[model samples]
Target: MGAPVSVTCLSAPVSVTCLSAPVSVTCLSAPVSVTCLSAPVSVTCLSAPVSVTCLSAPVSVTCLSAPVSVTCLSAPVSVTCLSAPVSVTCLSAPVSVTCLSALVSVTCLSAPVSVTRLSAPVSVTRLSAPVSVTCFSAPVSVTCLSAPVSVTCLSAPVSVTCFSAPVSVTCLSAPVSVTCLSAPVSVTCFSAPVSVTRLSAPVSVTCLSAPVSVTCFSAPVSVTCLSALVSVTCLSAPVSVTCLSAPVSVKCLSAPVSVTCLSAPVSVTCFSAPVSVTCLSAPVSVTCLSAPVSVTCLSAPVSVTCFSAPVSVTCFSAPVSVTRLSAPVSVTCLSAPSLSDVSLSPSVSDVIISLEVLASLGMDIQPG
Candidate 1:
């Protein structure tokens, strides 16, 4: 141990207490710091405004409230923070990433993963229904439709689909319609939707022969004549005919009117202006009342025979008028008419008579 030393200075008197050689001591002006060259040593300070600095070959220095640097020769390298203020950095592998409050399962282990949402249920229709669906993107679009409905569209996608309800197809142009009574509607491709024009019928009718005149009729329109039959093709389209329900025109030729009895060619006794007789089918026979050597028959074969001569006969409007010629005028057996008149006027009064006969087997003569 070193002895105590006293030192007198102008400013103050100081004393030093040292325990060993090469130790540090101080007065009121300086802080008392103790150092040892050998082993461990301890020192205490009892005054304020004191400062101490330590340096050693194998030791660390720590300053409570001053900027100081310390170096340790050898130490285990480890970093741990517990119940103290320390800054730390992480340098390790990674774990998993989780999203909160997710009902469906989703995991991102791959670059491109598919996330699917549950699709709506599809029911069965007679024609068509949604079979399946898929998502190409985050969100997907859907449509549903059925068949057999007639469709007319101005601008369409060429096709459409429906999931619910039976489809009805009709033509806006002509009277064409496609109805789905019990059959479900189908996917109507504009290329060929059930055509409204395509239909079927079960009945056919025919007439035996022509009437007094042949007439063809269509209630709504007219029919086309094929051979002797009239056929109605489309009820929707325009029906037209030349002679619809009537003859095109009645053709009648007027002949010189004259009367004839059955079989014999004799002079035709016609009254007033030349008579007009209508020539119908079949031959007519004319008979002369006065029989000469022979009866003269007219050349015209028509039922209405034209006589070359005009016989004067005055008569009034009566259904039947007959005249009885006396001995001079009558040469044959002349039948009496319903309304009979005797001979009149000249010395040989020639009575003229007219009678209507049908299908009589009597002799007829046409006058020259």
Candidate 2:
């Protein structure tokens, strides 16, 4: 065992803390089976904000690949660096990142300089030499479920892109494309990219060159309601929507309609099941009123097609607001408003009349 080296990194604007200690302790000078001895150490600021780098013995402790964003941070903290038999604390002057020992490292990759978050190319040069770290960008999170925690996920991107010519690092449209270009120093995985989308359009939708690139993530071609009176549930991941819920009752382009168990400790069964709830539509779109229940016009004359099971709509606001529903739309049910008596407003009178007229002619009034 040898006396480990120490280094500290101050917050940005404050240049890196170098291991400038002149104290020299030669590891070779020790006797046979010699006890730990201090070695001459040199700390360099590979980059600002990053405090110290013990050049003597490569102190490879676990590092955070994902930006550890602590919203509840009370004060500035220190990120300590460690070597076997001894540990070093690199103080990042009253800054937030307090790296507690939460992970382990298997290998250390060096290019004179290190970097992270490569969406576009941003380069760095260290060790009195120049090197390149071409990093790729992903649209979503990649999970290495079985691997260690050293996995690389570019929350955003920067690159050591300065070169003689343009070096193109393919930016993946999806998380699955994050394969090692050459070789990775180490890898880790948490939760992989889960497929979530609106029946109409999905947010956080990745940039893809092909359709159904990942079929698991594809939005349903269409949803239909087979019954006028139906009960729909809401579900998220790993919950099958096909089961226990009607189709198309869950309209896309609506509100933040998501699937959740009618009750707590909800047990999920199939893939599309329980029920799917997501705020799909926009301001001019149909907004979900309740849990797979009611909906109203966000603006005027909005059309909404349900995606879940048998469901109905009961207008709560401006009953006579919506004008011409050009797109095929469905009528929702009143929440627990027993059908004792209900009447369409004068504004909605023509809508119901014309629809009935079209129904007689077998004309489609809603988006199928």
Candidate 3:
């Protein structure tokens, strides 16, 4: 019923070895009828008809778009599906399923399994055993009600459960965890820890609930949280934070750290650790960390956290940004000062510069 299919390897060395009793020998392929043995066997068919039956043997099977029906009676197996739909039914066998850009459905009875699917929906139902499932870009629903299970879903939602074993689920949206007689863990919504338990374990948990740190400099309004620690550095500008529940530390040249705090302390340092701001009703600790810098505080009882070496600002009105200057100092002004207004020290020498004889000779001065 599907499109044209290619089966690359199938060998039937001996003709029909038909027996009512279960055979346990490796067998090859025929165009329409291919049966294998109890020993693990590999079969490849190129544009061959799809009838492959293996009795009591583990198998590695690959088919391109032709409905592949492989029944592994009792053994472990691995299946990979690409671009086409594949349905694998394993009876009392441990299985590993990988689906890439295709829809895959797997049903296993009394087996432990691990399934990884990318870009498509993969539904796996395992009755018992430890299960690990990871899905990317699409939804993955797994129901394994026997052993420990861990599921990670990225950019999509996931629903997973383990009855008598622990279940771990991490997804983009709200993830639900239901278990009895076992511990359960869930992480959802931007690295936020969410825990669910009816009576024993905590019913709900959300951590790093808000953006940890946000910084914007010379660009459009941007906000980002660096989880656990919040540090913002702005140039000579204005920075405002709505609610900062964590310890707020700021070190800037001339910028102001204005914050309305509901729960935590605000610390600001400026200059060499110059500008320090302490605000709201919370107790604050401040450290002047900069040198040769200007400091402006807008609150009371300012404390220093830590300070480096001594720093001095020699010139402020001219906006001179040098900590130390070397001699000899040369001075030039937009408007020249009068000779009497200029005072020369003992180290200064006055040389009489004259060009009278060259002007008398009618020679013009030009920069070569």
Q: What TM-score against the true fold does each predicted structure earn?
A: 0.12, 0.25, 0.46
lDDT for model 2: 0.25
Cα displacement (angstroms), candidate 1, residue 158, comes to 5.5
Off by over 4 Å in 3: 1-37, 45-53, 172-181, 188-368
What is the full ranking by TM-score, best candidate first? 3, 2, 1
TM-score result, candidate 3: 0.46
State the TM-score for model 2.
0.25
lDDT (Cα, tens digit) per residue for candidate 3, span 225-343: 22323455554444444333555555455444444443455566654423323243344444444432222222222233333423221111111111112112122212112332222
For model 1, the superposed segments whose C-alpha errors exceed 4 Å read: 1-126, 129-152, 157-195, 200-368
CA lDDT of each candidate? Answer: 0.23, 0.25, 0.46
Model 1 quality (TM-score): 0.12
Candidate 2 residue-wise lDDT, 1-368, digit = tens: 23343424343232222233332211211111111112332322322212223333222222222211111111222233221111122212122112222221111122222223234222222212222232344222222212221223344221211212111222332232222111121111122222222221111212222121111122222211111111222233121221122212332222233332111111111222222332222122223322232333221222333233222333322122222222222354222133222233223423333343344334478864
Which candidate leads the pack in lDDT?
3
Q: Is candidate 1 or candidate 2 better by lDDT?
A: 2
Shift of residue 5 alpha carbon in model 1, Å: 86
